[model samples]
Target: MNFPIIHTNFWDAVIAIPIIMIITQLTKLIYHTPSKFVPTIALFFGLFISIFISHRHDLLAGVLMGWFYGYAAIGNYAALKTAIKSYRNANK
Candidate 1:
C-alpha cells in the first residue's frame, strides 16, 4: 500500500487541533454530551475537518491525520485538566 504524501502546513500545526478541541467542547456545552462520549465526539469533529477541509485531496491522509488530530486534542484536554486539578489541590 502506497502512502499519500501528506504535507504538514500551518493549518495542521496551529489550527486543526485547537479547532477540533473548541468545537468538541462547544458541542459538549451546548448539547450536554456525556463525558464518556466526549472523545468520540472530538473524533467525529476531527474527521469532518480533516476530510472536508484540510486534507480533501487525499482520502488516506485525511483519515489518518484526522485520528491524530482527534486523539491529540483529547490528550491535550486531559493533560490540561489534570494539571489544573493538581494545582488546585496543591493550593488547597
Candidate 2:
C-alpha cells in the first residue's frame, strides 16, 4: 500500500477552520427538523472539505482539517443541545 506524506502549512489551517464552521452551521440549520442529522451531515461535509479544499498532496492538511472540523462539530452540537434545553425549560 502507498501512503501519502504529510506537510503542515499555516495557511491550510487558516482556511480549514472557517470552512468547517460554515459547513457545521449549515448542516445544523438545514437539518433542524431532525437534530440527529446535524452531526452526520457535519461529518460528511467535513470529510468532503478536507479531501477537496485542504488537499495539499499531503496527509497533514487532511488531518488538521479533520481535527478542526471534529472539534468544531462537537462545540456546535453542545451549543445546540444547550439552546434546546434552555428553550424547553423556559416553556415549562
Candidate 3:
C-alpha cells in the first residue's frame, strides 16, 4: 500500500484542531447529543474534513491527520476542564 504525503505544520495545531473542536461543540449543541459522544463525533468530523477538504487525493494522509485533529480537541477539552476545576478549588 502506498502512503500519502502529510505535512505537519503550525496550522494543524493552532488552527485546524481548534476549529475542529469548535465545530464538534457546535454539533453537539445543535444535535443535543450526549456528552459521551463528543469525541466520537469530533473524530468522524475530522476524517470528513481531511478526506473531503484538505487531502482529497491523499486518503492515508487524511486519515492520519484526522486522528490528530480529533485527539487534539479531546485533549484540549480535558485540559480546560482540569484548569477550571483547579481554579475553583483554589478559590474555595
lDDT score, candidate 3: 0.83
| Candidate 1 per-residue lDDT over residues 1-92, each given as its tens digit | 77789876865847988888899999999999899999999889888888888889988889988888899899999999999999999998
Candidates, ranked, lDDT: 1, 3, 2
The segments of candidate 3 whose C-alpha lies over 4 angstroms from its true place after superposition are 1-3
lDDT for each residue of candidate 3 in 5-40, tens digit (9 for 90 to 100): 686677656877788889988988899999998989
Q: What TM-score against the true fold does each predicted structure earn?
A: 0.94, 0.52, 0.86
Clashing pairs in 3: none
The TM-score of candidate 1 is: 0.94
Deviation of model 3 at 45, angstroms: 1.4
Residue 64 of model 3 has an lDDT of 90
29, model 3: CA deviation in Å?
Answer: 1.7
| Model 3, TM vs. native | 0.86
